[model samples]
Target: MRQYFPSNLKHLCSHYRSISDVCNRLKIHRGQFNRYLAGTSFPTSFNQKRICDFFGVEAHEIALPTDQFLQLISSRTPRPTLAMITAPQRAVEHLRQCSSSRLQDLVGHYHEYAYSISHQGRILCSLVSVKELDGHIVYERVEPSASRSNGSDRTSCYRYEGVAYYLGDRLFLIDYESLATSEINQTILIPSFKTRNARLNGLKMGVTACDHRVPVCSRVVWSSLGTKACGPEAFRKVREYRDDDQELDSDLKARLAKAQIIDGLFRII
Candidate 1:
């Protein structure tokens, strides 16, 4: 479907000099906002909401299909596909006990908790130093083409430090870096293994224009497994296996089970 932003936004504030004006108000850069105006890029749902707040407009108005078209550029580059990891049998058995509804609830809760931690404006603008204790896993911040429209499209600018690890059934983010450490205290969602490839090659993570801005990392887990872990509802579904009363359909249950099992073996070293 085609997408667009409201035309009236340009005419609203007389003092607004350029897309830069809007971005400055929004705390984003001029070029990034220009991409949105030109229809060469599309903002993620989170950014779309931020843009709406900046312009004093509704989210729907700022994300009109035609606006997306204006910034649309056709690229024929082929993206990399994520590698499939094997899940543990024990994890599958554990997930089989829960219903779909319960699983949804688990994912939802996790998402809300994570969002609350990240939305507090704590992690923005900081120099983070990264270190891998276990292995040669290098985590570098990159600016992906997908984030070009978000008004902070600078490439690999911010130096945020954090260690990424794989838990039993999820990915965890711990802030050990000096930058924004006091403000950000807790494990946040970096990305799930299922969606790691999309985040790395397609959506781009760890890159932000401003010093204190929260990096825009696409929740690729949702796109990869056809489910989201960014909200309470989705979290419940992923964790539903812990429930005993209801049962999900075989296919969905299998996927969740697999995700859980895979999460156990891949320790981010």
Candidate 2:
């Protein structure tokens, strides 16, 4: 038990930045902490509880053999099921299981509009299809073209296909670029279907540049196009809206102005 105790203690301490950091967090003297590490002594019951609480583990950790301890802890962890392997699939599945049935309302086609975070103030627009297939909701976005700044009447087209799901009140769309440009996008949608606001609003974050690339991750606002349109009309709208030569959905415009990115609500990977 003594042999196992010191080895296990060292293993746990190694997780921390340093033995001194762990000792400081434990509020124990450094000398005493080192003695416990050397297997020459052990923590008091009270101190053991403090250590366990700090690490968010049980007090019996010290008695556990290093291997058995790791196995036991790992066994308690929630493992991902097959469906959760992809962010798109996971988002779609989570939305279905979430307490609210509002996810069903989002099933349909929408034209997504947002300003490019990487390109400064330029608008990025695309058409999307969201629907349930078999047992999950899938998201497909098609960006027909990137508008030319010089009004050259020519544009670059692309498509993104992926799965989408919602957590709590927020919806997530994870997509991949068709070419090997290594692009992945995460578009967040907030449900604003109530109170005459038919369009949903959220932020789109992902890789913006391919070669000389902008910052690693860029952020942009995405809102739904109010009414559905056929190919020619939709494509025209996507371009005109880019240069502010066209009108935006009234609800979408209102939502964007009111929305502010909450720093505490976001985290960097």
The number of clashing residue pairs in each candidate reads: 46, 2
- Over 136-168, each residue of candidate 1 has an lDDT whose tens digit, in order, gives 122322112212213343433323344344444
- What would the TM-scores of all predictions be? 0.22, 0.53
- Give each model's whole-structure lDDT: 0.34, 0.64
Model 2: colliding residue pairs: 91-165, 92-165
RMSD of each: 22.5, 10.6
- Pairing residues by index, what is the TM-score of model 2? 0.53
Those runs of model 1 whose alpha carbons end farther than 4 Å from true positions after fitting are 6-9, 12-15, 63-269
Give Cα distance to truth, residue 41, candidate 1, Å: 0.4
